[model samples]
Structures are given as structure tokens and as C-alpha cells.
Target chain A: MTSYTDKIREISKRLLKEGKVDMVIGFTRGSVPMMHQPMFAKNQGDVDRFVWDGNCGINLANYVTDRKEKIGIVAKGCDARNLAVHIVENKINRDQLYIIGVPCTGMLDRHKLTASVAGEIESIMEDEAGKTVTISGNGFSETYDRAAVLQENCSLCMHRNPVIYDELIADKVPEQSENDVDRFAAVRKVEEMTPDEKWAYFDDLLSDCIRCYACRNACPLCYCPTCFVDESKPQWVGKSIDPTDIRIFHFLRAYHCAGRCTDCGACVRSCPMGINVRAMTKKLEKDCLENFGWEAGLTTEQRPPLDTYKPDDPEQFIK
Target chain B: MKNLLEHMGIDPGRLHFSWISSAESTKFVEVAKKVTEEAVALKSKEKKYMKTKPKVA
Candidate 1:
């Protein structure tokens, strides 16, 4: 990962020096352990601050929306897919970007790592071989296999290499084959439950929601000028933390991203209450894939299934 | 919309979608009857998403 960081800095510096892009977006070490913050490098001097590691879970595609200046963004597989989405949506132009693709090796889940130990994490170090992560706190220190603590989305990722890139930092890594991972196993578990059981399951899942909207803010797809939740004429969702309100908020938000979500795990990563917000979105993703033979952000040339009319489109639900 | 609602444990019959032109009264009536029958069948199930009166102040 250090070599990845070095290569990123080298490329970003050259881009900045040559005046190819007005800004370069990448990740920098966060103030705390296992939280990487997005950094915008506008000049050659700022290039040295960029770093890459397992902690860069936040999607860089969120930062490039509607930007007027040319951008050189550091994109992993999911981020690059999102960039493709942005291009298709006309939020940004393809000519305005210089995508620095980083073939991902999955991001570490901080919650999983924290749950493994009893104390607060003071520092974390990833081995040069990129196979192990060591964390130390007050009195305890432990090393964990990188694969064991990977975020759920990362483990199930089918596209680990960027779909689009101007230049890649390293040779593409192997992708997770469909046979190796049952991507819809969680969705299937929920599907088997009775209606009452399913309701109770989601009720328990969203019991801790604080209505902070961290998930909304973190998502790259949520760029609406006046989100439905904020509408006054006929407010689609209540602002209070009522269980019904929370459920509606989550449901509608998931609906909005029906055919466009890349399952980048930004919503899951940003939740302060540690909600598995992917539960709602992943169901839609599975539906899109199964019903329409569509996966979001795979290409910019074609519109999503939901956005276009097709003669063979599934209409089973419409009686 | 119906798929997601059903996925969240809502009764699939509660929502219905049909393409009926204004002149097609027979088709509209036929679809409406089916929808109402399905909704009535599940009437005994407790409503899942309806906002109720505050149980406690």
C-alpha cells in the first residue's frame, strides 16, 4: 500500500505541475486510527499529503459532482464505477477528469476490528506485504488477517479493478469470482422470513437510528437539491425520530438509488449509530440484477434499466 | 415500489398498479375487483407501517 501511495503522489505531482488538472482528489491519514479523510490537492506542494491504504473506504466520486474545474481523482473499483455514473447522469464531463485508478484489495471494517478487542485502538499499522493489520491500544496489541476484517461489501465485490481509468497505479488484482461469493446470501435470508418476521427484523435493525443523515451526506448519488425529506409543500417523510419516520426515510432513500447504487459501503461506513444501511439498498441492487439483468455503473454508454423503456422489461408485479 | 414494500414485509396486495385507459371500464373494474379481494383477504393482519396514536406522552 505504501508503494501505491508513492505512485499516487508521483502521478499527482506530475499532473499538478503540468497543469493538466486544477485539483487532484485522494485520501489522507485521518486524525484517528482507521478513519481516512478525503484530501483535495490543488497544487504540487499538496501532492505529498496523499496516501492510500485499506482505510480509504469513503468514495472519492462524491467529491467530483458538478465541479467546474478539471479533476484528477483517485478512484478504486467502486469509485470509478460511480464516476461512470456521474458521467452518464451529466453531473460531470468525461473530458474534465483524469481518473487515477487504484486496483482495490478491499477496505478494512473498523467496527469489526474494534469489536475483536476490549480496549480503544490507539494506532494501527498495515504490513508492507499488505496481508496483515496490527493494532495496539492501552495494554493490548493484536494482528489480524486483512481479509478477515474486510468490509462486507468489499468481501463480496465482483469488480476489484476500476472499470475506467486514465492511468492505473499498479497492475490489476484478481477479482472475486461469482462462484466464490454468494453476494445475495444476506438478502435471501431476509427473503425467507414471513412478513411479520421481516418487519420485526428491520425494526430491530433500525432501532438505534438517530436520524443524523450521515448516510445521506456520504452517498455520491444523493445530490438532489431539495431531498424529499426536506419538502414543505407535501413533506414525503417526517423529520422526527419516530420509528415510522425512520423506516420511511430509509425506504425512500433506498428507492431513490434503485438502479444506481454501486454498493460502495459509504452509507454503512458513515453511520454514527453503526446501522447496516446496506440492507435496504442491497435488496434493490439484487432486484435490479435479477429482474433487469443490470448492474449500476458498469458503463457510461448505456442508461440504467430503470431510466429507459424496454419491451422485455419485467412487469410481473403489475397485475 | 411494490417489490421493495413487499420486501419490507408489507402485504403485496396493499399496492396495485394497472394500465387501464379511461375508455376501458371493463378492464378497470376487473383489476379493481381483484385488488380489493386481495386486500380483504389480508385484512386480519396487523397494519405494519401505519403511524398510530402515541401510546404514552
Candidate 2:
């Protein structure tokens, strides 16, 4: 398989040399092994620092919002969708972007790998074409099929190719067939419980939250100048990590991205406490798709489901 | 949720509520299919309108 790293370098260099963009946002080798950090390259010399691999999973779209300089961004499927959401939400202008779209198969779930392996993980490597991962620790090493380690959101993704792009770096990746995939199976399981049971379930799920706000900062959809949590005029949620406050914080966070979330999994990936925040967002996504036949970031022209309404809408739930 | 969305001028279609016990698998499928059809129809109508009266950007 062709190296995505090489292609990203070529495209970024060309864009910078041609003055097509003021800066290119992509990934660079992280200080730690088995990870990558988002970086910006403003000149041709800096493009060489750009890298792409299974570890380059952080959504680059988060860095593009409110950027005055023209930007060229390397976007995976979810990142592209989030950009589309940004365009529709007026967070960023589409005219200011030169999107380098990547047809992502999936991203590696680092937390899963960390939990399954023994000892401190010293080094890790992945061969995307071979669909395998090799990890070496303090005393042992092993290789496993890459599919077994895919991020949960990626495993269940319906749109694996960019729904919008300025230029695709490679041929579009085929979407996973929905025939047997139960993307909402977990959500449905939680829904089957009684109100008290459901409450306790989420309470336990978010119990480890430290109120760090990494999830919010990582999300491209979250760009409000004053987040509701930080509002002083009418503090919507407590700043402390009280369980009830945490619960409301999560609920509001998920609600804010109701129709706009692409299920990018960025929030879960960035959470220091390893909370499965997708549990909340996915429920809203299922509801939006089921009720309004809407998926966020598919088109720039169409307003989000919640932004527009028809006179005769499904009101079975409303009294 | 429906009440809040309604007050906000968002389509009530944006929210759906139904009760399906684990034993009522058939009822679940039936409700799902009906809701899917309704949403599809609403989207089609919106698309048709947008095509006829394209919004100026």
C-alpha cells in the first residue's frame, strides 16, 4: 500500500509552495510512542514534518475554526464531517479551506490496547496494509490482527470516506455494510432499563470524570466563546466535579452536539478519565437519524435537523 | 425533549419516543419501520422544496 505519510507530505508541500494556503494542519510524530500530535506547517520546509499512520487519529478540524489564515487540513472521514458541521454552523468558512481528505479504514483504540497488554507498553508499531499490530513491552512482545483493536466508534462508523472534500488523497474507501452492524445496540440496551436503572447506569459511567474538559476542548463541534459550564451570569452547571454536576455537564455537552456530532470519537479519545462519552452522543445521533433522517456534515447547504422544521413532524413523544 | 425542541421551533420530528419491551421485538421493528418511512418522506419533501426555491448563499 502507498504510504499516507508520503502523500500528505507531497500535498502539503505543493500547497505551501503554491501559496494556496497560509498553513497546513496535519499530524507529526508524537513525543511518546504509539501516538501522534496535531501540527501546523506554514512553509515548504515544515511540510516534511507531517506524518500519517494508524496513530494519526486526532481530528485536525478542531484547529481550523476561527482561523483567519487560509488552511490546508488533512482530514479523515469524521474530521471532514466535522468540518462540514463547522461550515453549516458558521464556525468556519468553507472558502478558507483546502481539505486533504483521507479515506480512513479505522483508527487504533489506544485504551483497548493499553488495557489488554501486560506491563508498561514500551513500543508499538502497526502495518495498515497487513492489518496487524506489533507491541513490545518491558519483557514481552506480540502481534495481533488490527481489526481486533479498532476504536469502537471507527468499528461502527457508517461513513468511512469523506462526505465532503476539496481533494481526496486517495480513492474513496468503501463503506462498511450496515446489514449486520448494530451501531445502536449499546444505546438500545441502556434504553431497555427503567428510569432509575438508566440514571444509575450513566451515573456510574461518568463517575470517573475529573471535570478536566479535555473532551470539550478536543471536539471540533464545541466552539462557543463562553461554554455553558463557565458562564458566571447564570452558572448552568457547577464547576466542581460533583456527580450530579458531572452528569448534567455530560448531558449538556452531548446535547449541544445533538445534530452536529459526526461520532468522530475525538471526545472519548481525549478524555483523561477514559469515559465512554459516545454513549451519550450516539443516543442523540440515533434519535436524529431515526426521527429526522439527518446525519451531520454530509452537506454544506442543508441546515441541521434541529435548525429546520416541518409542520407535521413526529410528535409521538410530545404531549 | 420534544417539548423543548417544539418551543425552540425545531421540528417535533427531530425527537421520537416509543416504548418497546425486550419481549416486543416485532413491535419494535414495526415502529422502527414506520418512523423511518416518516422521516424519509419529510426529508424528500424538504429536498424537493429546496430544489424548486434554491436558497441564495
Candidate 3:
């Protein structure tokens, strides 16, 4: 994706030089391998530090909330969706910013890559043309098919092109067809389990949780000024890493994102324990899609299903 | 909230929602009876989310 990086630098430089925006948000290589950190470029000089590749998994939309300054942001498919959500929520105005949209071809899953190799990965190289990834550490170097290591949410993504943008970095990539990807396959598997079995499934899944809140911090949807977990007056969830507390935390967090989540996979990516947190959120997403014929971030003009009242809304669960 | 809780393996019967006004006393009683029956049926299953003594310490 060298061309992507070059184009981003050129655009960001021009935007900065023209004083169109006070800052530009993008990704830069992180301190470690297979991790990219969000970089804020306030001037033309810092624009060169911006880079884009498979490791640019951190959603840049998380940084733009409630900002007063005019901004230009590098948004991939998921980030752009989150931005649309932000605009709909009135967190930021559309006129105050410029969106540099990039057509995304999924990101690599660090957990999958790390698990496939034996030692610490020293470097990672992507062969965009060949659709292969090469990783080297110490005396070992190995290559693997890119599709095999793609993030789970990305592989199942139907929207690989930004839904909204001011400018495009490349021609829009073909989106994944619904027939090609069963986005709810994992949720379906969980749904098929008995209540006791499902309980055990999530219990085992959250067993490694450290209550670090990395997932919440990483999520662009989690922009609450006072998150439920931190509210001392009404302690909705215990601070301890008790299984019940962890379960409640996950449940509530997913609930909060009910109609707003884009299934961007930021929570799963940020989890230090490698927990698949999307399992809970995706169920809500699936329900929203099936019951309400709604997909979050697709359009800013319409409010999400949960946010509005409709007489025809399903009430099958009601007595 | 109820749908998600059920999706996570909680018994669908454990939680109930109804839209009965105070004027509709008969409907309220019927809904309450159904909810109680469902909760009683699930009494055999172990409580899932109740807090217990810390496992870490």
C-alpha cells in the first residue's frame, strides 16, 4: 500500500498548506511490529509521518469526537462508518471537517499472525499484489496467504468501501457479497446452544479478561463522558474481574452499541486477552438488521431503530 | 436487552416485558402470572449472573 501512503501524504500536505483544516488524523507505524498507532498531523511536516497498510486497524474515528478545530481525517470503510455515526449523533458537524476516504482490503489479525508463528515477530511485510504476507524473526522467515490472517470481522464485512467521504484515495473496492460471507455464522452457533451451554461458552470466553477497559477505550462508539462502569453513585458493574462482573461489563457495553456499532472490530483488536468481544455486539447487529432492516452508519439522515419509536416495531418478547 | 441476554444463553423465559396500563388491571394480572410461571420453571437451573465469593483471591 505504498501508493496509498504517498497519496495520503500528498493530500494531507496540500490540505495542511492550504489551511483547510487545523489537523489531519491518520495512522503511523507503531513502536512494535503488527501494530499501528493513530497519528495527528497538525502541520505539513508531520504529514510525512502518516502511513497506511494492513496494520492500520485502530479506528481513527475515535479521535474526532467533540473537536472544535476543523479537521481532515483518514477514514477506511469502518472508520468512515463510525464518522457517519458521529455526525448523526451530533458529536461533530459535517461542515467542520474533510473526510479522506480509503477503500479498505481487510486488516491482518495480530493474534492470528502471532499464533501462527513460534517467536516474537521482528518485522512484517505485505505483498499487496500477491495477496501474501511475509514475517521474519531471528533466523526464521515465513510467508502465508493474506486471506488466512485477515481479521474475522473484516473477512465478513459487506462494506469495504467508505459510505461517506469528501475525497477518495483509490477507486472503490468491490464489497463482499452477502452470499460470500455469513456475517452471523458465529452468532448463529452461539444461538443454537442451550442456555446453560451458552453461559459456559461466554464464561470460558471471558475467563482471560483482566478488566483493563482497553476494548472500551479503543471503541469509537464508547464516547460516553461517564461510562456506566465508572459511575460511583450507581455502580452498575463491579470493578473486580469477577466472572459475573466481566460478563455484565461485556453485556452492557455491547448493549450500549446496540444500534450504533459498525462491527468495526476495534474492541476485539484492543483486547489484551484476545477475547472475541464482537460475539456479543454482532448478535445485536444481526438483530437490528433482521428485525428492523437497519445497518448502522449506512446513512446519517435516518435515526437507528432503537433511538426512534415506531408503532409497527416487533414486540414478540412482550407478554 | 432481553433479546441479548437470551442470546447469551440466559433462559428467554427469565425476562418479560409488557405494556399494561393501570386501567388494564386484568391484562397486568395475566402478564404477571405468565412471568412468575416462567421464572418458577427456570428455578431448577442454577443462577447464572449472581455475584459470589471472589474466585481470584
Candidate 4:
């Protein structure tokens, strides 16, 4: 596989040279050493500043969606899918975009991966042998086995291939999860538990929460200009660390995001509280898939499953 | 998610990770320290594992 640096340079050069786009929103090495964040390039000098690899991990769709100009983006599989969702949401004008699709195996969890080779990480790049990550530290340079060093999500990604893009970089990768797992099956199992047991588990879990709203901010579907949590007219959820308020906060956010959520797993990853709230989202995704035969954002013709309702729809479990 | 983080090198006993509706930080700092220690320990293990490879079979 070609390194993203080369691919991004080629795409940027072409976009500028052909006058096909106005700007390139990609990623480069972060201002902080060893970190990676989104980088925007408009001029040729900045094109050389672009870099792509597992390290270009942040979903850049949000940046592009928030803007109103003609822009080409460096999108990996997930980022591209998110862009598709944004397109359907009407948050972005699809015609204005020139998507440079890059197939992604997955992204490394930077904190975990960097610390794994702390004081190393001389240069990060990929090649035919897989990720050619060369790390030099403490008077030694060691090469890590690419696949093993890849992020956890990359190993089990169902959509390594970009769903939509103007260009293709590699042969599309296949979906990873196929089993029709009853998403509500776990919730049902919990329902069977005594109320005491249910709360016991919940209490055990939420006790570590240090209320940082990373989940809300990370979500692409949660595009409310003003969230209910911040509204003081009703004081929707308590300001302090009240446990019930926390519960209500998460439940409301997830419900608001229901049907809209793409199950990108971004919310869970962004949570400093470490709540893996994706469990709720996965359940919602399964419901959308099984009942309405819908997967969010894959098609422009379909309405969000929760947004539409039928008289005969199953409400047996509804209180 | 707990299981997944464990793979990333978090030990629940020390670095308690859970949903917000569940926290009881009565001993917040003590608990935080324990969690930090565990995370650091796991990171160090990854450092060792990643740095040196065993003899190939």
C-alpha cells in the first residue's frame, strides 16, 4: 500500500492543479510531538505538511461538515462513511466535496500505541509488509509488527472499505461482524434481573464517572446547536454530580441520538468516563436493522427508522 | 467495554471504569491513584512486550 503522505500529496496537488476543489482537509503530525490532529491545506507548501497513516485517526468529517466552502477531504473508511451521513443530513453540500477515499484497516489508539513504544516512534509509515512503523528510542530503533501494533477497532472493523468516495486507493475490505446478534438480548437479560440487581450493576458501573461530556461532543449525529444539559430554563439535568441526573443525561442523549446514530463508536471512545455507551447505540442500530431493515446513512432514499412509525409497529414492550 | 479496555491494559480493580450512573467516588483520590497505577503498569507491560520479542519458534 502507498503511504498516505504520497496519496494525500498526489490528491492535493491534483485538486489544486486541476482547480477541482478549494481546500484540502487532511491530517498531519500534531503540534505536540507524537500526537496527530486534523490539518487543513490550501497552498502547495502546506501539502507537504500532510501525513496519513494509522496515526491520522481523528474523524475529520466533522471539520468538513462544519464548513461551507468547496473542500476535498482525506477520508478513511469510517471518516468517509461519516461524510456520507453528513451529506444525507444536509449538513454539507455533497457537490462541493471531492472525497479522497483511503481504505483504512484501523487507527491505533495513540495514547496506547505511543506509550507502547515510548521515547521511540522515529517515523510512522505503511508499506507492503503492513505498517512500517519505525521507532527509535533509548539508543535503539525497533520495528513493530504492523498488524499486531494496529488499533483494536482496526482488527475487527466491518467497514475497512470506504462506502463512498471520488477515488479508491486499495481493494475494498469486507465487513467483519455478520452474526445477527439480538441487540436487545442483553437489555432483556438485564430486564429479567431483579431491580436490585439491575441497579447494583449500574451503580457499580457509573460510580467511576467523572462527568466529562466527551460522549456528546464526539458524536456526529448529535449536532444540536445547544444541548439540553446546558439549558438552565428547566435545569434539565442537575449541574452537580448527582447520580440520577447523570443517568438521565446519558439516556436522553442516547435516545436523541437513536435512529440518527451510525454506531461509529466515536462517542464511547471520546468518553473520558470510559462508559462504552456504544452498547446502547449498537442495540439501537440492531433495532433499526431488524425491524425497519435500515442501516443509518448508507442510502439517501431511506428515512431514519425512529423518525417514521407505522400503526402496526411492535409496541408490545412499550409501557 | 471493560473487557476491551482490559485488553488495552486497564485493570478494573485499580482503574475503575464504568458508566456515570454507577460511580461512588467516596475515596476519589485513593481510587484515582490506584487506577493511574494500574494504567501505568499496563502501559509499561506494553512497552516491554513491544520493545523485545521472544525467540521465534
Q: Rate the local accuracy (lDDT) of all candidates.
A: 0.92, 0.82, 0.91, 0.65
Which candidate gets the maximum DockQ versus the true structure?
Answer: 3
Q: What is the interface RMSD of candidate 1, in Å?
A: 1.6
Rate residue B4 of model 3 by lDDT: 94
Q: Please provide, for model 4 over A213-236, each residue's C-alpha lDDT reduced to its tens digit, 9 standing for 90 to 100.
A: 777777777677788988888868
Best by lDDT: 1
Candidate 3 lDDT over A205-265, as tens digits, reads 9999999999999999999999999998987778888788988899999999999999999
Chain B TM-score for each model?
Answer: 0.75, 0.63, 0.76, 0.38
Candidate 2 residue runs with Cα over 4 Å from true position? B2-57
C-alpha lDDT (0 to 100) for residue A275 of candidate 3: 96
| Quality of model 4 by C-alpha lDDT | 0.65
Q: Where's the lowest-lDDT run of ten residues in candidate 3 chain A? A: A234-243
Model 3, residue A237: distance off in Å is: 1.4
lDDT score of residue B34 within candidate 3? 85
Q: Where does candidate 3 clash, by residue pair?
A: none
Best by TM-score: 3
Model 2 Cα RMSD, Å? 12.8
In model 1, where do residues sit more than 4 Å from their true spots?
B52-57
- Model 2 agreement with the true structure over A1-319: per-residue lDDT tens digits: 2478889899999999899999999999888766789999989999888887777777888998888989999999999999998888887899999999999988888888888877877888877574899888888898889888888999999988988888888888879877848899888887667544665677689879999999999999888999998898996876766665676788788889888999999998888777998988898888888888898889999999888888866876632
Model 1 lDDT per residue over A1-319, tens place: 8899999999999999999999999999899988999999999999999999999999999999999999999999999999999999999999999999999999999888888999999998999998999999999999999999999999999999999999999999999988999999999999999888988889999989999899999999999888888897896777777788889999999999999999999999999888999999999999999889999999999998888999999897676
User: DockQ-based ranking, best first?
Assistant: 3, 1, 2, 4
* lDDT digits (tens) for residues B20-54 of candidate 2: 88999998898888878777766733431122322
As a whole number from 0 to 100, the lDDT of residue A8 in candidate 1 is: 100
